[model samples]
Target chain A: MRFLTLVLRSLFRSKRRTFLTVLSLSVSVFLIALLQSLLGTMDALTTSTGSGTRFVVQDKASFTNVIPQAYTNFLRQQPEVERFTVLQWFGGEYKDPKNFFANFGVDPESYLQVYREEANLPSIPLEQVRDFLRDGNGCMVGRALADKFGWKVGDVVPLKSSIFNLTVRLNIRIIFAGLRKSDEMVLAFNIKQLQEAVPWMKGRVGAITVRAKNPADIPRLCERIDHHFANSAQETLSITENAFNLNMMKLLGDYSTMVHSISAAVLVAILIVTANTMAMAIRERTTQISTMRALGFRSGQILSLLMAEGLLLSLLGSGLGIALAMGVASAAAKVAGQIIPWMADFIITPETLLLCVLITLALGLLSTFIPAYRASRRPITEGLRAL
Target chain B: MDDVSVRLRNLAKSYWRGSLEIPVLTGIDLEIPRGGYYALMGPSGSGKTTLLNLIAGIDRPSGGELEVCGHSLNGLNDDELAGWRSRNVGFIFQNYNLVPVLNAYENVELPLLLQDLGRAERRERVLHALSLVNLTDRMRNYPRQLSGGQEQRVAIARAIVHDPELIVADEPTGALDAKNAEEALILLEHLNQELGKTIVLVTHDPKAASHARFQIHLEKGVLDRTVEVHDRPVLPRLLT
Candidate 1:
């Protein structure tokens, strides 16, 4: 601790160089944190605890393909099936195409029952749920969705479907909070209204979400449901909701690898930059280091002091970067939530922050080790000659 | 301990550049007794600084026994040599090698940091050393903020702050003006006579050599001559 002032003074000896190096480091660390958190968000998508009892039944060909509504009849007959809802993505624009959010056409009462845990339906007023089930044009919007548009109960919202070439006026009925922030960025209305608008969609649905009577029965129910539609004109694929999300993620093949590669590349680049900066700083102090050696400072002591300077530099840079990542992550999550509702949960978790700290320590030690060791081990007379 | 501050027997030093041996000092035998004032006088490439560095333990000899301040430097490892130096030898360089970032007081406090002294104790010793060099008022000023002479005084304060037994100065007044050089020489005399420190100085200036009681001249890595001066001047004014 007595040598702290010396180390700090040495760091600022080249103020401009130090400032630039720190700025570059902060930016690189910020990028690393953001990319790592993105990977975390993707991982979060496929590992929700509430999804264990819920299964999604989509067309075997592709999620974009619609399956027959007649599949629900078999689901209703199954003793393991507690409730089921038919869901269709209604890709719609509010005031502008840019103001896009997740809007779905669903069987209202059944959808609420299947997603009761996620929607936190126990907290909603019973009257609001009844109002949604009674009114044909009524819709249930997530709390975040309502907040985004400054919506209130009884407010009429008009959504124009880009795919169906029609506009549907929906009365806001129940505003529901969800188990996760990402879940609260959706709006759902009755599939009956969509069928009324386009008669061709009457007996079809994008997918069916089913809740099992017991979590243990989910795997068997999936297998049985898929077997019932085997060799049919409209084949179906039934999977737990988590597996469904995982399959959706697989569509963007090896995305984790890409994110990791980019992150590794950024880290390596920053390491090189920081190493060069430290080498230059140490080189500039060759004579001063020798003077210290001549004053009876051991090689180990010299190495320790230089390493401390490097560590302090790393901590300062990464500290700023982590704070910057947090602020930007919050804002970016909101903007991304408008287009991809699940992305609203994009966050720099404590685990990510801890990983960044470990990286900072490694960067500090690795970048400064070789140069500091060389300088400290250099013969004192040779260094004195540099004077 | 022995009254002899330094003793050398057939001391030799060489450098190698990719297996080609280059001798800097060879077959040197010398001694400077305790509280003795001596100067090493030689032209460039004459090994005066090399011998001083050997005696100061900053460099090791190629082959020979070298002892300074009652410690045999040949057997000591690099770390042990550094430890021995911290407890026994002080050095004043021609370039005034004060750390540019540290002020005069902090620079003087450098050697003390290697010791197990408390903050108050270190502060007291540093202030005393600065006072001895007449730099008490300039203690807070950095090397760049001080004049060349003042910088050298700070270096001298740093050297003596630990109160070592031997003070090895390599052309300490080489970069100073005439008045500053005279003042520095007088200060060296005060340290030798009043403080009873063994002073071994290396210089090319004949006038600087004249201030020492004995002068050892080197020529081509060997001792050429030794002269004793009976009329070494003592400036009482600077001593006060």
Candidate 2:
């Protein structure tokens, strides 16, 4: 305790320098936590919807490609496919070009039933759905996207399509905010509206998503779906949700490689910064450390005191950074909610928090190893003479 | 009762600066009896500090058997020697050697902290020791805030706080002004006469040496002469 008093006194003697070091540490940790949280939120969005029984049948060339609209009709005949729906990636923007959200042209009935667990689309009364679907351009929007623009049930919103140069006048009859993950500012307009709107709308649809009763039936169902479309002009590539997310991760330039490389850089930088602090503290305390030893404090006490200082500082810095991260993530969720509604689900799991703390302690240990050893093995006389 | 608190026979200390065998204490033979105040006076490089160091267990002898408080100086390890020194010998260096971070009270209480005493007991002992040096009022002041005399008194308080059998002072008054030096010398004499704590002090000032019940002067690593109170009248007599 007395040793800690000594350590604290020495550090606070130059209060500005210590505060600056702590501030630098906080900034470093805050940035690291922010980047990691973004990645974490992305992963959560991907993994939460993963089910082996559900396979997305998209064009082998690209996910955005339109298979013949006739293919969905042909694939419905397959016994292995329990239920299927077309997932159209309707690229559209709301308000200004800066405002972004996913708009998908989907088969509203089958899509809602298939992904009822993940749909953030509001539960419109069957009468309301019929009323909303009464017109071809009538759309059901995500409530989060609705709430973003202060939209209510009767708001007529203008959505401009990026893929097709058509301006969509969507009469928002009902908002379908179902699950937390799928809440976005997307308009699930009638496929007929999409077919009539686009120039290349001749018997074309985006993709078919198939769900089987048994997970074991997925691969055979996929093969069956592909076999049915084998003779068509457009071929199909069927992949499970996990595989789809994995492919998305791969789309970010090899998930394991990039995350590993970036993590290594971050960790190295943290180590260097923390070690520099320890070194400076040790340098200043050369005499006091010797004095402690001369006062019958064991070598272990000196080492423990130095390590404790490093650990305490780092833990506090990291702790504050993480707290700030949660706050920033929540505020960002409101802003990003317009674009990626699922981003609000950025979560810090216990495993992740434990990992963060472990990183802090590890950095503490790693940075202080040399400084503590150097301080401990130092001769009392020489250390005293240094001051 | 055995009066000898320290005994050194044929003690020699040498330093190897690169290639040179620079001998500091050459063949020193000395004895310090318990409860007696003694001063070791010498010029620079005359082995006064070296001999004091060996007696205090701060340094090891290069060649020869030296013993303090019945422990074989050659046999004890560094840690054991430190514990042994803590239990037996208190130290007052030229710079006082008080931990600058601690106030006078904390500094006085340091050595006793090594013991297994409770905080209240430690406080009592520390206060008692400070009272003997007449520094109880200055207990809260840090070393920097205290005058040289008071700092030395606090150092003295720290030394005797644990009630060690012997106190070793190395040029205790060297850094003090004449008044502070004389004040420190009076405290040392009081500690010896009243508390009966054995002190092996090293100094160069004749006035400081005169306060000791025994004075041993060294020249060129050799003990020149041992003088008693009756044999010296060169300075003010504390007893007179």
Candidate 3:
């Protein structure tokens, strides 16, 4: 503790160099934190416990291929299948193409039953839910979506579908709040209204969501469903909801690898910059180090002092980076929610923070070790004569 | 050996420049009794500073036996020698060598920290040492804030604060003005006589050498001769 002030004072001896090095380090750390948080958010979507008991059945060719509506009848007959819903991705634009949000056409009744945990209907009045279920043109917008567009219970929302090339006008009957902010970025309307209005979407849906009676039965149920559709013309791919989201992520093409690569590069750059800074600082202190040795301070003590200075510099930079990352993440959650609803839950987890801190510590030690050791081991007479 | 603060016999040191060995000191035999004050004087390449470093245990001799305060430095490892030096030898440098970031008190407190002394005892010793050099009022001032003379005084205080048995100085007043140099010399004399610390100083100045009880001159890598001073200057009683 007593040596802390000495270490700190020595670090700031060249204020401009120290400040620039720390700034560069903080920016790199911030970039790393954001990238790690993105990977974490994606992982959360595919591994969430809530998705364990649910299965998604899509056309075997691709998720974009529509599955026949008859698949829902086959799913209902299975004893392990507790409830199911037909979900169609209604890629629609509100007012402008830039104003985008997740809008899905779903069976109003079964959608509520299958996703009761996520939808959280208790927050809304009972009368609004009845109106939403009974009225063919009635739709339920999540609280976040509603707040974003200044939508009220009685407001009529006009959505122009990019896929169907049709415009549908519906009255909002329920404004639902979900357990998570990401869930509250969606808007669900009656699938029947979309089917009746569009000729191509009459007897097909993008996917079917099946809730299992027992989570333990999910694997068996998926295998049975896939087997049933094995020889059919439009074969189905039945997988857990988590695996379905993972498949969707895969369609985006090795993004995890890209993020990981970019993260590694950033770490290397920061390590080089920090190492150079520490080398310069140690080089300048050669004479002082010799004087300390002459005053009976051991080589190990000098090495430790130099290492402490490096560690403090890295930790302070990382701490500031983490704080900046949190603030940016909060703002990004709102902005990204409009473009990618799943990203609304983007957050820097404690584990990610802990991992970053550990990495920073390793970086500190690794960047300064060789230089500090070399400086400490230099000939005392030679160093004393350096000045 | 019991009465000697430093003893050297056939001590030698050499440096390697690629493939060639350039000897700095060779076949040197010397001794200084306890509480003795001596100055080493020579030309630029006389190796007086190198010899001082050897006696201070900061440098190892290439050959022969060297002992300071009764500790044989030949067989000790670097860390072991450091421990021995911490207990027995203090050092004053030409550049004042005080850590620029540390205040006067902290600089003096550094050597004590190497010992098992508690904070109060370290503070007491540092205060006494600073008072001996008459710089107690500048305890909180950093090295940059003090003049060249005052900075050397802080260096002197740092040297004596740990109460080592011997104090080795290399051109201690080389950077100071005439007035400051005289004051530093008087302080060195006080530490030698009053505190009973054996002092070995290396310098090129005749006036500084005249203040020592004896002067040892060195030629190229060898001891030339020794001269004893009969009328060393009497310092002011203020140091008492």
Candidate 4:
């Protein structure tokens, strides 16, 4: 404890050099935190959905291929299927093409039933649900989506779909709060409105999402649904919600590999830079170190002091860098969430934070060990002779 | 306490450069009794500093017996030597060697930090050391903030702060002006005569050596002469 003052004072001896080193470290650490968090968020997308009971039924050819709404008849026959909804993506823009968000044509009652837990349907007033079920033109907007567009109950929001040559004037019937962050960034309207507006879409939907009566029944239900449509004109593929999201990510190429590669490369670069800085710092203190040795500081003591300084430096930089990353991530989630609903799910989890801290400590020890050890072991007389 | 403060029996030291063995001091035998004030005088490469380092336990003899302050230095390892030095020896260098980042008081308190002392005791000793150097008012001044003479005085205080029995100074006033050098020499003289400290000084200046009771001269790593100064008078103590 008494030696702490000396170690601290030594660090500030060259203020500019120390500040620049810390700044560079902070920037590198910030980048690593953000990148790691991105990977962590993508991982959570597959792992952390509220319940494992939900699965999606899409065309085996590709999820982009539309399937017939008549498949709900077969789904109703299965006792393991509690409820199901026809969902179609309405690729729409509000006013300008830039003001994009996820809007879906869904059977309101069945959607409210199957997604009751995720969308917090029980929390909404009974009147809002009734209005959504009775009016084909009415819609239920998520809390975040309503707040983003300054929408409220009774506000008529118009959306123009680019895929289908039709426009929708949807009356906001309810604003629902969801358990997951991404769930609160969607607007689901009654599919009857889409079917009536676009005649050819009357019996078709992008996908059929089913909620299993029991979680243990999901695998069997998936097999039964796929087998029912095996020889039909449009074959069906049944997968859990998690596998669907994973497939979506796969379309963006091997992002996990690319992200990990970038992170590793950045880590190595920072390690080199930090090690070089530590070496230079120790080199500049050659004489003082010898004087300390002469004053009876043991070699191990000297090494410990230098290691503490290195740890403090790395911790300071990493702490600030992580805080910076959190702030940036929060701001990005809000801004990007308005344009893409999934961006709202972006988060830096506690596990990710712990991993970053561990990396910082490892970096500190690895960067300072060689230089501090060498300096401590140098012959005392040789160092004393240094000017 | 042993009557002899330092004893060397056929001490030899060598430096190795790759496969070459360069001898610095060869078969040197010397001793200084307790409370003796001796100056080592020699020209360049005469190994005066090397001998001083060996006596201070900062360096080891290649093949000889060396002892200081009753401890046989050759038997101790590097860490043990450092512990021995902290307890028995104080060192002053030509450049003062005060850590630039620490203030006068902090610098003086450095050696005491190695000991198991409480904060109050450490502070008391640091203040007393600074006061002895007549720099208590400048205790907060860093080395860079003080003059060369003041810095050397602070270094002197640091060396003596832990109350070691022997002080080894190598050209302690080499960087000082005449007035400052004389003042520093007088301080050393006071430390030897009034405080009963055994002092070993290494210097090239005759005037500095004259302040010591005896001068040991070396030529080419070998002792040439040892002379006792007869004309010098016992100086009055200049520090309280």
**Compared with the true structure, what per-residue lDDT tens digits does model 1 show for residues B1-240?**
699999999999999999999999999999889999999998899999999999999998999999899989999999999999899989999998999999999999999999999999999999999989999999999998999888988888888899999999999999999999988888888888889899999998888888898999999999999899888875685443
lDDT of predicted model 2 = 0.75
How do the predictions measure up, each by TM-score? Answer: 0.95, 0.87, 0.92, 0.96
CA displacement after TM-score superposition, residue A137 of candidate 1 (Å)? 2.9
- Selected candidate, larger DockQ, 3 vs 4: 4
Give per-residue lDDT, candidate 2, residue B215. Answer: 84
lDDT of 2 by residue, A82-135 (tens): 778876776777778877777777776777666655663345567767766576
**Any runs in candidate 1 off by more than 4 Å, and if so which?**
A77-82, A212-224, A247-253
lDDT of each: 0.91, 0.75, 0.90, 0.88
Q: Rank the candidates by DockQ, best first.
A: 1, 4, 3, 2
Candidate 4 per-residue lDDT, tens place, A1-387, comes to: 898898899887888888887887778778888888887777767765544888999999998889999999999999998888889999877887887888899999989987787679889999999998898889998898888889999999999998997789999999999887778888899888888788778799999999888989999999988999999999999999888888888888888999889989988998999999999999888988998899888899899999998998888878987888899889878887677677788777787778778888899899999999999999999999988
Better of 1 and 2 by TM-score: 1
* Per-residue lDDT of candidate 2, residues B1-240 (tens digit): 577888889988888999988888777788888788889887887888777877877678899899887778798875776678668878786887777768999889888877888889998999898888888898989888998889899988888888888888878898999989888887777777767788888988888788788888888877788888655333333421
Give one digit per residue, the lDDT tens place, for model 3 in B123-190. 89999999998899999999989999999999999998888999999999999999999999998998
Error of 1 at A186 (Å): 0.5
User: How many backbone clashes are present in model 3?
Assistant: 0
lDDT rank, highest first? 1, 3, 4, 2
Candidate 2 residue-wise lDDT at A39: 71
Q: Candidate 2 clashing pairs?
A: A119-A179, A120-A176, A120-A177, A120-A178, A121-A176, A121-A177, A121-A178, A122-A175, A122-A176, A122-A177
Give the candidate order by descending TM-score. Answer: 4, 1, 3, 2
